[model samples]
Target: MKRILFVLFCFAVTSSYSQNKISKNKKAIIASVEKHKQSLIKISDDIWALAETAFEEHQSSKILADYAESQGMTVERGVAGMPTAFVATYGSGKPVISVLGEFDALPGLSQKATPDKNPLKKGAPGHGCGHNMFGAASLGAAIAIKEQIEAGKIKGTVKFFGTPSEEKFFGKIWMVRAGLWDDVDVNISWHPSASIEADVQSSLALIDFKVEFFGQAAHASGDPWNGRSASDALELYTAGVNYYREHVKPTVRMHYHIQDGGQVVNVVPDYSRLWMRVRDTKRSGMLPVYERVMAMAEGAAILANVDYKVSLISGIYEVLPNREGGKIMQSNLELLGPIEYTDEEIAFGKGIQKATGKPEVGMDSKIKPLEPTREHPGGGSTDVGDVSWNVANINLGVTTAPKDTPWHSWAVVSCGGMSIGHKGMIYASKAMSMTMLDLFESPDLVDKVKKEYKERKGDEVYEAMIPDGPPPIDEVGN
Candidate 1:
């Protein structure tokens, strides 16, 4: 009995020591983020003001890459065939940890840092998705981890990925194909959301493509019979898609934008273009719908006597949820407690909620409990989903705007440029940094996270849904 009691006592003492070490390291990491808080906010604000679009974020990317380099990390810019994409690395050895940062803004959402809807520049781009915060906070976390490794408090490597064009082209697809994540043991990622959660939910899988129709132009009234209208084909294709929607599963979502239709009312258009996207809960589920939709374009062309071409833009996989990683992230969130808001911030949040036609409940200050992984999660798509498939990715969502503020809108842009978004960005940096410290300290934790990732991945092989050539850097806008 005494021997057994002694063994248990030793185990307890070792566990206590481990917990103390983790706590101490997390405090240091949090302090590092605090120490560089102003610089981090400046990075976010700079990117926010630049409001550069996908693949065109040259200055935005430079700001982040320069900061990472100044922090003693080696940066390789213009990577994976993208001028805005880059990789920054620090330290050496096993358990390579990677974090993703995106700095692209949505087009035509240009708004100033005011609660009222005021455009900073009419018909310009804005940080509606809060990627300005996403990139900065992620880099801040990576820098914190880099500092720990520099101090000999942790072992292994830390990599920061500057993945651009996520708003349109799914930039990470090309990055993954270039084998950027091949050596990574794990990835830490987060998004600026309206609520805080250790995101265990999977995202929708999506496919983006453009359909162009060609025909012969003629005056509408002068030679009606001689003209075959490409605009007619465009209309029929959209009509066919609408009719097919009722037959699809509840998990399916389809959207299209008519980029070109007709030049004038007096002429039959010879050319028309449409940007189409198809999405489902899983890539496997999305494939058949994408195929059918592509086929519909051919049918439309035949009926309208026009020639149509379908060009692949890009596609992404659903996020592979890592329960092991999520559990660790949840602990860190709980440790940090809910984000407290000052009265001014709360009133600002309420004003946003009111303006956006939602209940004036203000921001969600509570940390949402980790949710069960849904088989058919309902939400938008992301390029991070592709990276998660390649590596064990722990995802997080921190509130950067008020509750129920319509995403990808001026409301989010308003808060993201001000203190509300700044607080959340800092909060995300601390939570992610603390979680990374746990991963760095516990190799067993990394093993468990990878084990879960492999089990979930099973026999399925990852195949990117892009064309044979490089990413469409020349593609116009979001």
Candidate 2:
């Protein structure tokens, strides 16, 4: 009889243990995200439908702000003097985790999801970068976390940052300059891509500048030698830069195009402009070369007898990899799983690829992961690099469009408003939310990330490379 009682007691104890484990797992804050997947998909679709452009995402901002506010978050608008930038905060305490969201469309990428290329509206802007999914996924994660906090399931704050003008202007750079990320413990961000992976790499430090030359306009044939040509100055500048390229470091990249080079060849062109980008591994390394490039512009103006103006439009620092934050985000990505394409989605991706005459359905998976503390340079630039300097940040990418679908093209734009894009957005949101939960549950992780950031930063302070003045956000194009 005693042996029988012992067996029953042991069974009861095991059952109780299993039940407790289930309860604990149910309390996992990431479940909040899974529970609200449909809502996230809807939000992503709505933002895609809006299709607002950089610095002009009023509708996108409104939609995000309204949703955040509806979820009981305190919404602050017009951050850093950017009309479309905002911050939505929830929860009242320490361990602040920020999720960065970008909602900017590319110009001249208007397209509808058809087998052949077709635009919804010819010459209209479209979300070629899938920023429509970006803002929505960010808001979705924020809302889910807010729900958990309200339910007493978690203890921490979540902030959703609506950053605009990611395409043309550096919205996050301006926000960083305003010290918006100072109080945040860590930042979690992701981009829609052709795969699911944590970006454990650094991007190139970049600086955008515009050079304008002023000259007296005169009729070419009538006033023969009387006119000083700004067009002549521009040509000289281009030549000088081409010559200067050989002297600069191999890693340093410089590219530019003439924005305006006189309207008529018959007239001594009085106005000419050049837009240029200078990039390198580090801002410090890039500065001297940038100075030389500027000197080239001055020499061009001098030779042409024209007044020259150089304007620093925008700049972004290289991404500082935080081991702790990256590991946490990557583990979450593993948990969230990669984006799975449906039959229709796969067909859509293939259709876009066929239309573009690209060989693959997704980006080449050849890009390997970076070693710890080592940086891998991306050919492109992002405002997120600016935020990384101030906060413990981790970024990831999930496949959304077809492989080799050059960004800011109709091919990308066509898929941006479809299911394939929405699936990637949802996957990113789930990963971001899970990463945030890991941070909230383990404060030591946040500390470790900060320590890594400090060790990487050394004695250097993060100064804005874009100059002391604010960038002109109101300007349409650079």
Model 2 lDDT at residue 305: 97
Clashes of 2: 6
Report the C-alpha lDDT of model 1 over 342-419, residue by residue, as the tens digit: 999999999988888899998896889988888888989999999998999999999999999899999989999999
List, residue by residue over 1-478, the lDDT tens digit for candidate 2.
9999999899677556644543342345456666767777777777776777778788889888888898799999998988889999999888999999888888777778665678888888888888888888888778777887787877989999999998876888889989999899989888877666677788788888999999999999999488999999999999989888888877799999799999987899999999998999888888888899899888999999999999888888888877677777765554444455677777777777777888745433222243465554656778888898888788877777877777777776677677777777776777777777777777898899889888887887888866676557657654
The stretch of ten residues in a row with the least summed lDDT in candidate 1 is: 14-23
RMSD to native for every prediction? 6.6, 7.2
Assess the local accuracy of residue 143 in candidate 2 as a C-alpha lDDT between 0 and 100. Answer: 78
- How does each model score on lDDT? 0.93, 0.80
lDDT score at residue 93, model 2, on the 0-100 scale: 85
Question: Which runs of model 1 end up more than 4 angstroms from their true locations?
Answer: 1-22
